[model samples]
Target: MIPATETPVCEAAGVRVVRAGRALLDDVSIALHAGELLAVLGPNGAGKSTLLGALTGDLSPDAGDVRFAGRPLKDWGLGELSRRRGVLLQDTATSFPFTVREVVEMGRAPWRRTARAAEDEEAVDAAIAAADIAHLSGRRVPSLSGGERARTAFARVVAGRTGALFLDEPTAALDLGHQEDLLRLARDRARAGDAVLIILHDLNLAAAYADRVILLQNGRIVAAGGPDEAFTAETLSAVYRTPVEVIPHPVTGRGIVLPLRG
Candidate 1:
C-alpha cells in the first residue's frame, strides 16, 4: 500500500469529454492511489476507452483536469510522463515484422538517456522473464500464436517499469491459461506498489483481480467502490441493462457474477 503521506498517483476531477459534438463522458471524478488495482467496467459505448484516453494524456478534457502527483498533466514533459506511466491500448497491432525482443526493447525508449538506459534494459529482461516469454524473445512477433503475442505485448508494457499502468481489455484475446497468467502478473505488479488500471469486459476476471471497481453507464460513472460494494446484481443489471446474479466465489470469496435470463 502507498504511504499515507504520499499524494495520489493520479486524479481526475469533474472530467467531461465531448467528441464530434456528442458528450462521451460527463463529470467523472476518480482518484488512483499507488499500489491499487482498479478495474473500469461498463457495457459497449459507455465511454470507458475515452476515460482512459483522458487519463493517459491522449485526449484533453474540455472541462476539468487530470493531475499527476498533484500537478497538471500538461505540465509534465513527455519523457517524464512516459517514465511515470505505461499504457496498453485495446487494439495493439504491429505490422512490422520485428522480433519479440526488439518489440520489448521499445519500452526503453523513454529512458534512453544517461544511466537510465541500462536500468531499462535490466527491467526489460526482468519483465520478459516475468511474462514467461524469454524463450520467445528471438521469435518474430507475427509468427507467434495469439496468446504468445498477447504475452509479448504485456511484457513490453511491464518492461516500461512505470509506477502506473493502464491496460484496456488486455486479456481479450488470451486463452484461459494465459489470462490467468496475465492476471497473476498484474496482481504481482500491484503488490509491488504499482497502480494498475484495467478495462475489462469479463465481470469474473474483474472481480477476481481488481481491488476496486468503477462502473460506467451512458458515458457516466454509475458506481465506484470495492467488489462487494460495486458488483452487486442490481448494479450490474442497471449498468448493463441485463439481469445478473452476483455470487460468492467458492475459493477466493470475491463477488462473481452470472447472467440471468428474465
Candidate 2:
C-alpha cells in the first residue's frame, strides 16, 4: 500500500463525459496516488477508456474537473504535460517504417529542445532495458511480433520518464510471458513512486498485481478498494452479470475469480 503522506498524482472530481449526445461517463471521481498501481477493470462499453481519455486530456469532460498535482489538467502546457504523464494506447499499428530505437526516441520529443545539454542517452538506454527490448532496438517495428511491438510501445512510454503512466489494455495482445513482463514493469514503476493506471480485461491478472482495483459497470464505478475488498464473488457476479466464485490464492492470499455458469 502507498503511504498516506504521499499526495495523489492525479485526481478526477465529478467527471462526466458525453459522446454523440450520450453519456459515456457520469459523475465519476478517482484519485491515483504515488507509489500505487491502480487497475481499472470492466466489460465492453463500461467507459474505462473514456475515463483514461479524460486523464490524458485527449477528451475533455462535459462536466467536472481533472487535476494533476492540484492544478487543472487544462492549465498544463502540452510539452509539460507530456513530460509529466505518459500514455500507451491499445493499438500502435503504423505502416511507417521505423526502427525500434527510432520509435522509442519519439518519447524524447517533449524534452528535445531543453534536453540537448543534458545526457538523456542513459535514460533512453535504461528504458529499453527496462522494457526487455534492448536486444531488438535495431529491428524494424513492422517486422516484430505483436508481443514484441507491445514491448516496444512500453519502452517508448518509459523513455518519456513521466511521473504518471496511463496504460490502456497494455497486455491485451501479449502472450503469458510478455504479460508477466509488462505487469512486472508497471509494478516496478509504481514501487518507485510513479502513479500507474492500467486498463485490463483479465480479472485474475488485475487481482494479482494491483494495489487497488476500480470496477466499472455501465459507465460508473461499481466498486473501488483492495483486491479482497473489491473483488468479492457477489460483486463480480453482479458486475459482470455472470456467476463467479472468488477464491484465495494459497500463497499470496489474494483474491482470484472463477466463473461458474448457472
Clash count list over all predictions: 0, 0
Predictions in order: lDDT: 0.88, 0.89
lDDT over C-alpha atoms for residue 226 of model 2: 89
Candidate 1 TM-score over all chains jointly = 0.95
What TM-score does model 2 achieve against the real structure? 0.95
The sequence of per-residue lDDT tens digits that candidate 1 reaches over residues 39-153 is: 9999999989999999989999999889998999999999889999999997677878999999899887888875768787688899899888999999998898877887888
lDDT of 1: 0.88
lDDT (Cα, tens digit) per residue for candidate 2, span 70-188: 89999999988988899999888856889998898887778876854263687788889888888999999999988889888988898888889999998988999889988999999
Residue 45, candidate 1: alpha-carbon lDDT: 94
- The TM-scores, one per candidate, come to 0.95, 0.95
C-alpha positional error of residue 50 in candidate 1 after TM-score superposition, expressed in Å: 0.3
